[model samples]
Target: MTRVFITDDHTMVRRGLRTLLEELSGFTFVGEAGDGATLLAQLHHQQVDLLLLDISMPRLDGYSALVSIKKEWPELKVCVLTMHEEPYFIRKMLQVGADGYLIKNCPREEIVKALETLAEGKQYYPAEVSQLIMQDLVNGTPKVPLTRREKEVLKLLVMEKTTAEIAEDLNLSTHTVDSHRKNMLQKLECKTTVGLIIYALEHGLG
Candidate 1:
């Protein structure tokens, strides 16, 4: 039997998923949690085959939680179900060791299928997730390994905004924006703002 646990901030979401999962045979609903911290605590005493987790939550976000869970239970299966459809977050979650990604609005059947596939030691991402991944690959944008903040800076800089403008928008000091600009220039191998912008455009980071 597949032991599945649901970790989401919404009680209704957990209840609905639990009900649907229980209707499916060969899978057992092991537990439910409102946040990653509680999920972590539960895993200390329970054995689970799959974890259906949300992206945004207190204590620990889904990506970070997946990293921690995988370190503790290296074989753990985690399927990230989130409302955020941004490719950046999706890529980061997968890179950080999530087994699968699904938008929160995904169909119930697809959610079930993703959990089952992951539990069986296979991998699956919802259609929307796969499409974004393919687009990133085809455009060669996903290879740029930058922190979230770095990517944000790249986006703003590509729009011809100065470091001070980006600083104000991101609520950071001008010095910090300058530092990020330098880091971006070094990482992107661009000597000028125009060069950096062009590089970002070419790589689809903008």
Candidate 2:
């Protein structure tokens, strides 16, 4: 059986999900928590195969908690079941290691399907999530217009090169390299290094 845990600030939400998941064969509801901290604490004593997470909670939000959970429990699968449908949140969650992203309004069947997919060690993003990602790509400026130097910097950045290393390799000062990184981030609408890397990989620029 797959042991699943639910973490959300809403008691009703947790109870509702628990009810739905209990009726599904092979899925066992292990526990539930009202916030991220309590959820993390519960993991210390429980064996969980998957975590159904919420983005907003008291004590610690889902974003920070997700990062911590992945760092400490790399084997655990996390599926974000939240109300946030914005492309920015979806990208940010994926960048931070979410195995799946499902809007709170997703059909009950899809939620179970997402959990199943993640439990099998595969990523899952519903059709709505795909549309959001595609919208972001279409609305954002084309990356091909970037200058050669900027593209070089982006490639090195995706390779995990530090600012100093990029500067040395390109024969530029650290300040200049930082400027390039900032510009790339702006042009790509990326808020973090991981986001930039994802963009590069998605566009085959990496």
Candidate 3:
């Protein structure tokens, strides 16, 4: 079971999340806090696997809290559960190490799915959030420029294609595809395929 903690300013929101977790089979609502400071304090005593955090809060905001959390507990999975859908907020949270991003108004099923995805050691950004990131990327520039072939490989990667499949589609050898993947990983400074996917999606390369 995934041990979950919630940090949101609203009492109703916390209660609602707790209720949801109680009804879910694979999740355990371990604890909650009204603000980031209290949440940080409680984390030291809790064995939490996942954190559902809100962006706007009293005392310490989510952004600062996220940075601190990641610095101290880099293995802990954090999902931003907020009403903020702006590109800036989404990008900021992802850059600061959010494992998932979900709007507060999203359906309950989506929340459960996001949690499950994180539990499986994968990142989750809802379709809307991804669209916003893509739009922002279109208006900006990539941090590290990618070659044309690299962009093609990345686009296929974002489509969830395997390396062999990508090679088949691009009429390249699997060895060549692997080489491209490695080069992209090095150039983008991504440690894993998922990180490469996130970076490519955020930079419009995908």
Candidate 4:
């Protein structure tokens, strides 16, 4: 049986999760809680194989729970269950090693599929989260930290604008534009124009 754990602040949400998982075979609802701390206690007192985690709760949000859980149970699989549908949040969760990411608004069937996939030791990214992953790839400008002007410059790079074009648009010198371009490429780890273009497209950068 797949031992499942449900964590959310809403009373109705916990019930709904229980019902949804109970309806599926080979899956069992081992425990549930209204916050991360309570959920952590439940897991320690009992046993759970998979966790349905919500990003927003009264105490210890999903991200924090993820970090804590991995520290205690590194192999535990966590599927983020939240209303947040933004690409940045999705990327953050995945980057932190979340087993799966799904928007709470998804159809119940997709939720089932996510669980079943996770049970088989595979990651399942709901449509919304997948789009965010693409954006992460696209907007991977760099970790070296960019000044506001440099960011503006990289945005132009995604548009395939040359240094001259960017300089004209931003009212900057060609040398300044070139400097920003080099920084963007180095920070984002992009070697060519096409690489940056693909990165922008993935990250939903304009």
Model 1, position 119: C-alpha lDDT score: 71
Number of the top-ranking candidate, with lDDT as the measure: 3
Candidate 1 collision pairs: none
Compute the lDDT of residue 111 as modeled in candidate 1: 82
lDDT (C-alpha, whole model) for all candidates: 0.84, 0.87, 0.90, 0.82
* Cα-based TM-score, every candidate: 0.69, 0.65, 0.66, 0.66
What does candidate 4's lDDT look like per residue over 91-122, in tens digits?
66776789998888789889999999999989
Q: Write the per-residue lDDT of candidate 1 for residues 1-206, one digit (tens) a residue.
A: 99999999999999999998889988999899898889999999999998898988888767667878989998988888889887767877877788888888777889878877887899888777788778877986545567789889889998889878999999999998888888777555467888878887888889
Candidate number that wins on lDDT, 1 or 4: 1
User: lDDT of model 2 at residue 27?
Assistant: 92
The positional error of residue 59 in candidate 2, measured at the CA in angstroms, is 0.5
In the range 76-150, model 3's lDDT, one tens digit per residue, is 999999998866577778878999999999999999899889998898999987786787678773356678898
| lDDT computed for candidate 3 | 0.90
Runs in model 1 with CA error above 4 Å?
136-206
